[model samples]
Target: MDLLRSLPLGLYLEQPVTWLHRLDPRVKMAWLMSILVTPILASPEWRFFLVLLLLVLTLSARVPLRVWRQQMGWLLLLSGLVLLLTMVMPDGLVVAQQPRLPSPAEISQLTEPFETLPPLPQPTGYQYVIYDRWPITITQRSLELGIRISTLLFTLIYGTNLFLLTTAPEEITAALEDVMAPLRWFKLPVTEIALTVTLALRFIPLVLEEVQNLVRSVQTRAINWKKLGFRGSAQVWLQVVERLLENLLMRAEQIAAAMAVRGFTSPDEHKVEWHRFVLRAWDWFALGLLAVFWWARLVWGGEA
Candidate 1:
């Protein structure tokens, strides 16, 4: 049930009101962007450093341990799964080819291997028999590449999760709108887009809650799953999903109706009241730290 409740990634922690939660949304946005962009073209070592940096930030934010435990568990599981798959799956070099049973000539050549001649040009690629049957060659380069890719993915996702954990939907939309405000000069519908994003973010948690409600509702009925069989159980789940979608649609319509009643018909008439983002000394200090991150990325980012 707790895992189900944590389905929505965009949930904001409202209580505790940590410093990260209180940071100016626009500044937070800047920090997010800086962290997000700096990792591109970075080596595995740099990405690992970024992962550590995220850990340090998460610790400093003072968000409750329980709040992030499930997330961290999922992240670790996901990362391990990815790494395991990478290790097990051979690289592109191991493409399928017609099976090559030892030919008479090859067998004869092998049987006559008494000559300790200078090592023949290293075979184009390694081919060693595994279990004296299946042949496989593991390449160091391929393994390193896979590990690097997995680490990169884990670091990027965990950092984004940290941002979503701390920031509110309204703050996210406002920060985006503020950052993209200059685009209005080009006659872009920035306000409308931002508002649309805001509504979408606002509904994410509600949709997750609706899912939980549907699950609980089904559970409360005490359906005998052992009696229903696999097909019946799947059908029951499908019906539940169908109802959930219908409820979501109905909820969306109600919201639309309410907005219409409140005169939210036109983007021009709709005004967004932004939570004022006053830059203080801490904000500057944060920016300075970001600058240092950029400098570090530029200088030592090539080492893996």
Candidate 2:
């Protein structure tokens, strides 16, 4: 349970503020968008570079090595499993380009002198023997595709983890609001959207805490899951889930009531006070980094 609580994947860490944490959240958001979009057109080689770049950023951020180590094990395991699956899966049938065997009439014509005709021209393309039944043969194309996909998966996971690790919930919401402020001109409910996201992130830890508490309560009561049998165990789980949901809903209602008391009826009427985000010198440097990434992508023409 402790390990589960301390998984550090989605949870935010605030201690020992690093340069990454001090950087403007909007800059971080731009960096994240670049990391996500650059891979779309990048070749396998570039994707691999992106993965390495993720590692480099993590190191430079100076986050605890153990935090990344715990996540790396799982990420590598998943990537390896996906690669194994891709390698073993048979690609579409490849049609042989070899010409058909020479007709018997042609053979007879050639052999009219009653001498063995020279062996017909060998097949021009690949030929698989009937007895050669290899279950899976990986091609270079398939390998390249698999590598690209794996790198993409790793990059997304690690990049998002990096952002969430270094950024606070409030900072994320504020950054989002700043980024999406333009939408307000088009009559979009940007504030409401940001609030929704903020509430969601804020509730995650609470929900997890509730779940842990529920599990501990059940264990303390000495519920015999084994002896309860399958049906009984299912019923118990359902009840536990129901209770958890009820508690969550009650807490939500309490929060809503509290907010109402404080005059938070609507986004338009009750605006969330956000620290005005100003782009610092480092923020421009971050944008420059994004520009460089895109320029490289354009020059390299990310192709398999």
Candidate 3:
């Protein structure tokens, strides 16, 4: 878990071979926009784009098959974990609805939410549920749901790979708020959001550094190495933990000193200039097309 937690976002980001990374942020955003949109309509639907996504990542990055294979190990583990989680969660076992006694709220509610509706149907395996003698065939629904989830996972894997491979996490966070600036209407604080995101990325390295430091300290103190075997291992672990706490204290003190030196306050921005970011023409076209496609899909052929 620790190893996976320490995995760099860059590990997923692939180096682009084509014009993708070169495109204006917006154009690059739009060109592959349907990569996200098309799958949405794909309930029991498959997109050429899904496979295309993989091909694009593989081709553009020219990553070794082994790297993909390594991902596969995690994927398999994830698939199993998903299956298990979905199978065991609240309604996961039934995969459909079952009724329970309504609360006083439901009984006294002015809302007559349910009428003569039959007992909430539960999803039987891969559809084809047994409703008395009748069956609710949901093979398509089941397949689509699974595919939808798989595609989501695929996007995450590919997108993370795409981001880490090309730009630093700092850059991606910058892009996110910059592109999503329209949301400020609802009073979204994009800058703070970006700061939080950057800190989250920074936290990864900070944690790993702390672990390494602790491990090294333990290694240097070889006195306990020969004195205890299994017990010694336990003592080393305890020592590592103590050292980890000490490191955290030191870091906390450094942060305090740095903040003091800068006269930092909660209200001030980090004084970072985002203009240094490259927003090329291709990027603009890509983003524009993405918006247009997304609008068309939602307006003309919505999730009907």
Candidate 4:
């Protein structure tokens, strides 16, 4: 019933800060974008390599087993299921057609018998149908599609999860603001946008807390579901939802009032630096490695 602990999707891990936590958020953001974007139109081998790379990063970082097990285990299982299902499904290669010319029987009857030309020497040993049996058939196209889909699914989810796991909400907003600094030239309110993001990230835990409290309160009331029919249960949940919204609005109001009391009129007037953005030696090293990553991707990751 503890939603916060059970579903730690965007929450940060504060204890036992790993090397991943120490790396500059900007570098991490760049790496995250690379992981997400590099798989497009890439070969299946490259896609699978991306998945393996994520696993290696997680292991090398020494993320707590409890944390990653919960995050990655189900994700891996789901991706594997997708791979299997995709492989078994039809790959749209099968087609039936009528021959334009005569069949072999008719040709033989029409022409004089001649020694069958020796079968043309086989060239490459490539087979379109990878596996065929009674109930299952796998084609090269199907296998490729399966690998593409499953690896993309795993990479998309786990890459973002890893970033959020190590980086704090403030750090995330700061990184985003830094990255978006160039947009300010077009009269964009970059500071305001960053402040909004900061507040939104901070509000996530509050939303979760409100939900947990409401659910706990409902459970403690010991409402008799047997006595109250389905309609009654629905009405009770509706009331809970209404109260949750009211509480959230009140929380927002309180935050605004607190800001007003602190004389925070505008983001430009009062800026709070969350984390000083600096590229340490390790961060520079990471950026260099990222460049190398893209180089290899361009050189060999393209689809045949």
Candidate 5:
């Protein structure tokens, strides 16, 4: 199993650079933040809109069908499962109410000419329970909760995935460092922080590679898992895990040594400008659209 190609989360797409890739990473970061933050306490309609918006963005960007199909297919399935589970679960809206009718003893004590009043009719056409059956009951609140949860899950994971897919690691670090420049006034090690982030991002692929290699090695050995039993399999995997950690540490040490050999002692002294930060026409247009997005959200996205 090729983990790199099969699971491409947080991995940037290098070929077929789309307009999304060309846009300033900083602007993309802002838009990503907007997509992630707008779902809080939002109406179900708004949350659904965000889900559609992310899908639209992915489609418009023309991301490879193979890439997004793997990413979104599983995510959509998970969201649907969550929605179904939530719909069947209790919504916590049940409350005890005093009966309108008096008890038999109390009724017997009533005045001589008293008669029972007619049952009152519902004033509105609203029904809280949408469906009822022997084993399953779905209420309006439960449905709303399902929609909210499913949409939020889709929005959070897919939104961040799209951002990472379009934006490169260098671009991400550059954008973050630029945005965090203000923290320098407080004597924070902004450059060092940026360097650390850059390394961390770059190290993801290495970690995946190590895992893939170890799994392939284990497969080539053709170990009889059925014969080995659970305890044997667990012990074998424990050794693999230990070796994986050692290899990762060695990789990190190699990277550190390479940097030192290249005369890179400190981040502030040996700063590497990965990408130039410049807002283009498309970026300004995106910012304008972002303003409109927020305006619409504030005006109509609140819960009923």
Candidate 6:
């Protein structure tokens, strides 16, 4: 139910902005996109590269190490999932503790009296890729591929964690609106786009908190979460989900009523002053640093 439980995640995301937050939201989002994809493109063993990137951002925002430490559970969960997939993949040549072949001693039990059996030996590493003349499927690569993908997934999740931790939801919403403004020429309802983002930002934390509360309540009633089997856990989850729906409905109604009372008209009802959001001298310096970072990666340094 940890998945169901709203982590105290959003609270961290409301991180106090320093130099990083002052950069235009559009610029930050661009930076994040590059940072996310860069890791995926980076070699599998280049996790250290991502780690360094994370550390630099953390220091830049003056983010707490303790908060990052708290997220270790989620990081482990992701890594464990990767390890499990690697161990149980079906398509790869299967390896086993007990050899399927008959040992020399067991050859005497052969149906034919003169039949002889070759000795069975445990393999250290003899992974032969069995040729499948049928159409090659990418899913066969799912586990190993999944492991690779998980690396990027965790990287982005943590990067996003940093962003959320260091920036306020309102600031993020403003950022989203600023980023989406370019689509206005296409008659895109930029306001609606911004609203979707704000609502998601608001609801993620709300739902996480609600779930944690319910899980704690369930625990108090003597249901042991750890010992529950898959089906048993699923049933408990269903009930929790039902309750969540009810809670969400009530909250939605309250929001609707509240908005009606106040003139909370639209997601982009109020525009942010671009000048106010612009890069200050420090922000300009940070932008220059970011450019240098990209230049080094793209040019002679050749290490992103």
The sequence of per-residue lDDT tens digits that candidate 6 reaches over residues 176-253 is 777778899999998787767777777776676777788787878998766988889899889988998899888878
* Per-candidate clash tally: 0, 1, 25, 0, 0, 5
- Of 3 and 4, the candidate ahead on lDDT is 4
Taking the tens digit of each residue's C-alpha lDDT, what string does model 3 give over 1-304? 3554446334534433434444444334434455655666643324434545556655665655554556655764675566444333333244766668676677778566555556776675444331223233324345445545655666656554554555556556767777888998988777778777876776666767788766665668666555678886787688678878888778767866886689765523544755465766656665776677566555654445
Worst 10 residues of 5 by lDDT: 1-10
Off by over 4 Å in 1: 1-5, 95-138, 224-235
| Model 2 bad stretches (over 4 Å) | 1-4, 94-99, 103-136
lDDT of 4 by residue, 1-304 (tens): 3788899466688977999999999999999999999999898889989999999998999988988897787999999999999999999966998889767788789757656677887699999999999689999989999998999999999999999999999999999999999999999999899999999988988999999999999999999998999999999999999999999999999999999999999999999997999899999999999999999899999988
For model 3, how many clashes?
A: 25
Reference-based TM-score, model 6: 0.63
Compared with the true structure, what per-residue lDDT tens digits does model 1 show for residues 85-111?
Answer: 665566666477775665557767885
The predictions' CA RMSDs to the true structure, in order, are 5.1, 4.3, 11.0, 2.4, 2.2, 9.6
Give every collision pair in model 5. none
What is the C-alpha lDDT profile of model 5 across 1-304, one tens digit per residue?
Answer: 3787777476689989999999999999999999999999889889989988988898898988988897788999999999999999999967998999778888788786358789899999899999999789999989998998899888899899999999999999989999999999999998899899999988988999999999999999999999999999999999999999999999999999999999999998889887898889999999999999999899999887
lDDT of candidate 2 over 109-170, digit per residue (tens):
78464555688887675443212247766766566667877888888988898899899999
State candidate 2's TM-score.
0.86
lDDT of each: 0.79, 0.81, 0.58, 0.93, 0.91, 0.66
User: For model 6, how many clashes?
Assistant: 5
Candidate 4, pairs of clashing residues? none
Which candidate's TM-score is highest? Answer: 5
How much is the lDDT of residue 209 in candidate 4? 95
Model 6 global lDDT (CA atoms, 0 to 1): 0.66
